[model samples]
Target: MHDDEEMLRRLRVDDLPPSMVDLNRAMRAGRRRERMGAVVAGGLAAVLALGTVVVVAATTGKNTAAPWPGAGPEGSRSPEPAPPLGNCTIDEAPVASQSRMIKIVANRSGQVFVMQDPLKSGNLLRWMDGRQERIDGVPTGDGYGTAAAVNGSGAFVGASGYKPAWVYRDGTFTVLPLPPDVSAMSMVGINERGDLIGTAFYWDGRDDTRAVLWPASQQGTPVLLATPAGWSSEAMDIADDGTVVGYLSHRTDNGPVDITPMAWGLDGSARRLPVPAGWTPARAGKRGPYPIAIAGDWVVGAGARWNLRTGTAEVVEGLMPMKVDKYGRLFGNVPLSVPDNGSTSGRPAVWVNGDVQPLPIYPDRPEGTLFSVSLDGRRITGTSYVTSGAFGTATWTCGR
Candidate 1:
């Protein structure tokens, strides 16, 4: 880690000990420029569907099928399932749950399932499965549980239910306990090789937090990330090359705050990302690297900060900073601060790149959102809970 990058990371996080947000206007702007994607000659762009934790299963069963999530524009496919009606943030509501999820896994052939459900009391466990259901294995332990993980093949999940992180393989839950020095942990993500990384707290018991990575090789204790001493962190995503996105923290003169949208590497080098120019009054903090849906020199995630490039952060310019796709296209819709109370109003949106606005869903769906993107990033899957003024979750494959 260069001293300059460390300095930048610190400077970016000098305020706000906690979070980031500024997405509404960016979506509106992207909507104006969306265009349909190209139809390739059977290019193997497959979409595997499933759910993660805290979701009721969609009874509609079919392998290659579109959702029956009723009502879109005059002529288009049905939307995805609506979430249980409520005001949970996109992160709070889910396309999938710990029980089941569709991850665009990198190293496997065919779809996989990372399932989590309850036993008696607050105890929890994770069951991993590959192409076959018979090959099921479950990992169990203490604490209340929920599995927030990266799907596809090489996936990882952690439970508030358990103390250490676990890996799911072809029908097996490999319980990789943390080092004696590490205490509570959250498994944030896994690379293609199943290398797991997340935030960790040491047994020393302080308000301190650091990033930790446990390799599939199973040899060493979780290594602490080289970050500043006082701040805490939350690991959002990881890349095949092991780039981690989260935040850096510090207590400004006012109170404890965080420098959001920060990124770090496997080598312990960290850099604070710059906020977009659109932020109001030019605030200094940034938001996230939502999981780098696509990997490379560029990072991608769904978040909002003033687009400093355009000088709009403080002024209320209604758009968001969308995720960058492997194709280098960015798909961002409005954030949760729209006119219809932001959370519910189906702010009909589009994807923009310069002057193009490729529309996503029909003008009136239950609720419109651009939530968790796919690994390939060809599509984005958010929720549209139900028919109560734009109140649902919907995901769309970016198209023409």
Candidate 2:
């Protein structure tokens, strides 16, 4: 096995927090899927050149890639017109093509941002009004640098290896302060109010990971979110209204277990998000459904949406939801297939009222994945796999 794959395997089997485990899994899965897609596409092209009719037998059982209770087939049909948001159109976004891997991280207002080669030392690119700029001077070294979340104002936050969490605004990098005695930290999301949220921990021979926040007014000191004893928390995303969403997990003799979705109010009070019926941490192996984004009263993650106000959870099934728009539309990807090994090949799609709408892909690039969606659900950004087996950044715009 390659070094990176081995490292990811160790991380999942060992003591990393649930959120970190999820991240590693996502990275590994993406790499594997892309490679596999390229091979399959190449082989199909060779077969077609010879005009051979290929008949592959189907192995039937419980398809792990089966759509959620009501979802349609992957790429089964064109997306239905989204009311109010209107019909959608797609266009290729400008990106540095030098990187082998590209990831669209966030879309806010009219600005769309991407990370080129995010798993390694990477570059941050931003686009607005037909102009693209590669933001320079982000910290890098032994660890990867990434911009996890961005707000409407274009200010972004993220972390690098062993470095304190930092925010970038107006071409300046502001390293966020850590609490006393904390050894390392990383920021994941920044709100319109400049409140930043992420995970912080120590390397002092203790398994301590906690969700922390740095208010816009006081960038020097971070406030640690409350967690029950024996529990560790990792903040994933913060809504503009100052609500933070993430997960809580505790380490057991075997590993981390009992991951529970959680949300924190603007006043710094933490509340547990409702879990879907029949959901169990063991089903996913030491991890529970965790919220990846919060818009208004909706907390979305793990193919489920939880209403903070109604205290109800709805499972969207088959979707690996990434972001939720204010209209309650969920934007993410669904698995095209799940191999016996459990890895999935995903196609970019959106779920409206429980119906999966496959996004339009470039005529030449058949594979893609969805990432960030604008609050209005009009503009979305992700990666498009080209014929050569490489992928590039892409964006889609929808309107009435």
Please, what are the lDDT tens digits per residue for candidate 1 over residues 1-400? 5422233343333432234434343442232122011111101111111111111111122111211112133332222221221111222222232221222122211133333332233332322342312223344454443444545653545544436456655545666667556656656667666667767655465655666777556525566655665666656566666766665544445542434556666655555554433332222122232333334334444333212011111111233333443333344444323334323233323333332243344444433434345444444544443243333334454332
TM-score of each: 0.56, 0.73
Report the C-alpha lDDT of model 2 over 1-400, residue by residue, as the tens digit. 5321231231132323333222234542343233212112111110000111121111122101112211233442122333455667777765444345543465554365645444334567765556667777877633555676777667788776556567888789887778777766656778889888877766688666788988787878788887776677788888887888887765566543456677776675556554565454433222356788877656687646765543456545556677778777787766555457655556677777666678888776766766567777888877777436677667888774
Top candidate (TM-score): 2
Model 1 bad stretches (over 4 Å): 1-137, 142-145, 160-162, 179-183, 201-205, 216-220, 256-260, 276-294, 300-323, 335-350, 354-365, 368-372, 387-395, 398-400
Task: Report per-prediction Cα RMSD to one decimal.
Answer: 15.8, 12.1
Point out the worst 10-residue segment of candidate 1 by lDDT. 35-44
